[model samples]
Target: MAERKLNGGLKAALEYGPILAFFIGYLQLKDQVISIAGTDYSGFLVVTALFIPLMVLTTGLLWALTGSLSRMQLATVVLVVVFGGLSVWLQDERFFKMKPTMIYLLFAGVLGFGLMRGQSYLRSVMGETLPMRDEGWMILTKRIALFFLALAITNEVIWRSLSTDAWVNFKTFGLTAAMFAFFLSQGRLLQTYGIEKDKV
Candidate 1:
């Protein structure tokens, strides 16, 4: 089927619905031990397992709607499968906890490498959505790259030093909020360099 572009609200839901599911699932299952067959599993572990399929489903739906998945979205699903699979199989939450760190670091590395090459990879990814001057692209890319790097470092410290519940809370809410705030803070730059309304 040819994919049809979805409205912003629907697109956002597909992108974020899985993560929201994980948070709600964890809260409902926290502190409980459930038996499957003869093996007992913690609520957090079960939620982690469920989260993998949910993410996959949402990603699939996104592709169905848009007829394409960004490289970043594909990478995210792959990481979730690898880390979440290991977490479930090993009954260790640490593996799942490190997933965000890996994702953030990978993004930072990609952006940083582009910067080193005097390129704006972000422009390649988002140029269609937000047409702008090359200078604006470079500036935004630099800021986002640094933001991703900082998030990666923060993820490492939070997951390593904090309790599982605390880490989950940070992952579920804090990271999303941070990203939103970061992008919202960039409105002036976007407007300053964005293609004029008539030009677009």
Candidate 2:
């Protein structure tokens, strides 16, 4: 696939369309029962089975459109297939439920590893978009890494202590909101550390 610049709308669709489909699939199928190989499965499992393939499809589409996938996107798709496949194969949803926790923890660990080496992987990924001094990058990376750990813990607690429906809602909306708020709260740091681009 050749590298191509994607318009914002197309990019967003490729990134988020599968998640929206999964949510809608679960909502519409939750009351229905599915049978596979003479065993009954809940709508959650069925939706997850569908979601795994949808995720793969969207990921492929993204690669086709952009000629590459980010590490984050690759990790997410792989985890979804692994955990979601287990949920469908074993007729249990717990594995799928743990996917978010696993992803967040993995991300946190990766960032922590970078921090241990006195490097900012976050800056490597976002530096072009958010230019800042090395000190600023290190500070932001530490904060984001800690935030990912907190999100991992939060996912574990919510899934274990709450209803499946509640967990789904939290996974879909609560996490998104929390991330948005976290970044929004970093406005001060962004402003303080941002390097002004030279005007043409």
Clashing pairs in 2: none
Q: Per-residue lDDT of 1-200 in model 2, one digit per residue for the tens?
A: 56678889988887778877878888998988988888898999998998898889989988988898878889999999999999988888999999999999999999999999999999878887788878889999999989999999999999999998898888877988999999999999988888976621
Q: Tell me the tens digit of each residue's lDDT in model 1 across 1-200.
A: 56478999999998998888899999999999999989999999999999899899999989977898889999999999999999999999889999999999999999999999999999999988789999999999999999999999999999999888889899989999999999999999999899974686
- For residue 57, give model 1's deviation from the true position in Å: 0.8
TM-score for each predicted model, relative to the true structure:
0.95, 0.94
Misplaced by over 4 Å in model 2 are 1-3
For model 1, give the RMSD to the true fold. 1.4
**Residue 165 C-alpha lDDT in model 2:** 85
Clashes in predicted model 1: 0
Give the Cα lDDT of each candidate.
0.93, 0.89
Each candidate's number of clashing pairs is: 0, 0
lDDT winner: 1
Question: What lDDT does candidate 2 reach at residue 199?
Answer: 25
lDDT for 15 in candidate 2 is 79
